[model samples]
Target: MSAEAVSALGLLGRVELPGVAGSICTARRYVRGVLRRSGQRDTYDAELLVSELVSNAVRHSESGRAGGLVTVAVANCGESVQIAVTDSGSATCAPRIPPGQDEGAEGGRGLWLVRELSLSWGWHEGAAGRIVWFRLARR
Candidate 1:
């Protein structure tokens, strides 16, 4: 993490959720509230990004085996906000843009939207699991 990244955003809130479908929505709202109060105008984008990250953790990771918790952390820098969603699974799969777009498709495209909307984004391997993080500049 860059000093610029850390200094800009304060620790707004941290949440731990069971790896379940419903938890994704809960995490999304939690993060959205943090950003909204931190003066973030792009609530929709933030919500979508948080949803995608949490959804991935819940659906892809092996649930109940060793148990898992989806951790959502929001930081508000003066100029931008950073959100990190961490999971307790070692799945090293990185998010990517889905090739081609089908209007009828029901999956993919989360990371694509994150890249398009966020000013900066990346992931890091942590001891507990992987952390997928994104930053949006205040507009």
Candidate 2:
């Protein structure tokens, strides 16, 4: 599933939260509940990816500002789970790997991990904000 997953998959789990640091854990727990309700037991990877994306949205996007917000959605495709995180637009930022980033650094590998762990991932930018999403094969 790709962008079509958003519509084709029919978002089963969705949440809106203040773009605060602690929301990362809240988003993870929410996803776990979504997965649990769907009868999926292995939730570690999905939770980790949601955490990274939420962290990025809160840390790098304008959503981090006072009164800002972020939205998370999860869709269950037949054989895969698609998750998306949308944040208020950032004037100076969109998703990307840091240029010439050090491989041994302690951080800055969130998107890298998403790219590696997800089956397929992409983003869509609209007037409201940009939504970055990843699809994971069901286990």
Candidate 3:
């Protein structure tokens, strides 16, 4: 969904996490806790995608800098669940997948993995910042 179109329908929960390595763990835990409360058993892909997205926000967006934060919104999308990560805008960068994968590189597989694991995913820059989102079909 577009950054401005972040849906509130069936919203399960949301959390604003500090842009730090530690926040990745927090994001995962938050997702797990929320999903568990909703009785979602297959959380593997959701957890992994959330980690990847949150990590990218921390590394590439302005979120990683001091005082910066990432906002993660989780919601139910009928047959699937939606997860969106929003970070402070970065003038030099926006979300994208490399034309080719460099398996030998130390990083850069985040969005590609998101594409593979989620049912639908896209990103957009908004008035406030950037929002990257994905939906995993519920099992």
Give the winner by lDDT: 2
Q: Positional deviation of 139 in candidate 3, in angstroms?
A: 1.9
Tell how far residue 34 is off in model 3, in angstroms. 0.8
Model 2, span 1-139: residue lDDT tens: 2345567887787889999998999999999999888888898999999999999999999999999998999998889998999898787887997777688899999998898899988877865588988989877
Tell me the lDDT of candidate 3: 0.87
> Cα deviation in Å at residue 8, candidate 2?
2.6
Model 3 error, position 66 (Å): 0.6
Query: Model 3 segments beyond 4 Å from truth?
Result: 1-8
* Steric overlap count per candidate: 4, 0, 0
Q: List the residue pairs that clash in candidate 2.
A: none
User: Could you tell me the lDDT of residue 59 within candidate 1?
Assistant: 70
Least accurate 10 contiguous residues by lDDT in model 3? 1-10
| Whole-model alpha-carbon lDDT for candidate 2 | 0.87
Q: What's each prediction's TM-score?
A: 0.81, 0.91, 0.92
Order the candidates by lDDT, highest first — what do you get? 2, 3, 1
TM-score of 3: 0.92
Q: Would you list the clashing residue pairs of candidate 1?
A: 8-77, 9-76, 9-77, 10-76
